[model samples]
Target: MGKSKEKRLCKQVKHDVLEEDLDGYKKLVVNPTHLCVKCGRVCNDPGLLCEPEPID
Candidate 1:
């Protein structure tokens, strides 16, 4: 797989945040239901995270 696809959203968002890519960030966190345990980043899809835990 390509590097981008291999990377979880948690890691990808770090770069997006650094570059101020608000649009990209928004697309990843539209309606977050899970949070990354490693970085505390929230996303709708748990598969996108390296370590995800349900928000509830």
Candidate 2:
């Protein structure tokens, strides 16, 4: 039997921001390209992705 890989929430992904992070930024991936919207089109490093939208 093979073990299934655990799904990581958005918070698990490293964003450029230091104070803000959560389990929703994973949606930033654009279709077909998988690019982050918050980081715009220039940023490539996941660690450099813009902070995820704040949760209220």
Candidate 3:
């Protein structure tokens, strides 16, 4: 009687989803999509968004 040995191979798959980018990120940059909604949506200015509303 002849017996054969079985071999098993396993490998890991790595995906580079997140990358380290510091080309232009060396300086502080203001986010344009950021909203300071403190007052209301009528105000388009970011600085004016923090204005207090008038009392009734």
Candidate 4:
């Protein structure tokens, strides 16, 4: 089994996620019921924290 990376608390990592940067995340963008697949951090209170940069 592969080892999982440790997750940083949202408060610890500085993010600059924009509203436009969350289209693929769908409702999860605003309603994160799970941790970010990449960052392993829970979604922000508003639930828009995405680890992957948004696609154009």
Candidate 5:
């Protein structure tokens, strides 16, 4: 059998994922997700953290 990299990876939420899923995760800027797929440590009380940018 091949060495599976996801051997120890969890399939649940973990990190503070953004509300929206961008195409190719580009807008996200990186591989961001609401749930930490590795440890399943979800942000139960994730607050709305964002900056108000100029809407043009």
Candidate 6:
């Protein structure tokens, strides 16, 4: 079986933040518009999340 191709926002945050990629992380979070229903993470791009819903 093949693994899923999508990379969720929560995973990105863990990777970018832990790796000290503040700039990359900032671009993802700046002026956030969507919330990840599954992980409760927020990001500007809904496509980055596993289950994204509009934030307000």
Query: Which candidate should be chosen as best, given lDDT against the real structure?
Result: 1
Candidate number achieving the greatest TM-score relative to the actual structure: 6
Cα misplacement distance, residue 56 of candidate 5 (Å) = 28
Tens digit of per-residue lDDT, candidate 4, span 1-56: 33223423342355332343345224333544556557665543323444533322
Model 2 C-alpha lDDT per residue in residues 1-56, reported as the tens digit of each score: 33223422233344342234322233434232323455433222344334433222
lDDT per residue, candidate 1, 1-56, as tens digits?
23456667887876666376677668779889999989888998898899999988
lDDT (tens digit, per residue) of candidate 5 on 4-49: 3342222111222232223412432233334443343332222211
Q: How well does each candidate superpose onto the true structure, as a TM-score? A: 0.70, 0.20, 0.17, 0.26, 0.18, 0.72
Which residue pairs in candidate 6 collide?
A: none
Q: What ranges in model 1 sit over 4 Å off?
A: 1-3, 17-20
Off by over 4 Å in 3: 1-38, 51-56
Each candidate structure's count of clashing pairs: 0, 1, 0, 0, 7, 0
Model 6 misplacement above 4 A: 1-5
The full ranking of all candidates by TM-score, starting with the best, is 6, 1, 4, 2, 5, 3
Measured over all alpha carbons after superposition, the RMSD of each candidate to the real structure, in angstroms, is: 3.0, 11.8, 23.0, 11.7, 13.4, 4.9
Worst 10 residues of 3 by lDDT: 7-16
lDDT values for all models: 0.81, 0.34, 0.24, 0.41, 0.28, 0.79
Model 1 has an lDDT value of 0.81
Question: Candidate 3, residues 12-48: lDDT per residue as tens digits?
Answer: 0011211332332222122332233342322222332
Model 5 per-residue lDDT at 52: 18
* Whole-structure CA lDDT of model 5: 0.28
Clashing pairs in 3: none
**Model 2, stretches more than 4 Å misplaced?**
1-34, 51-56
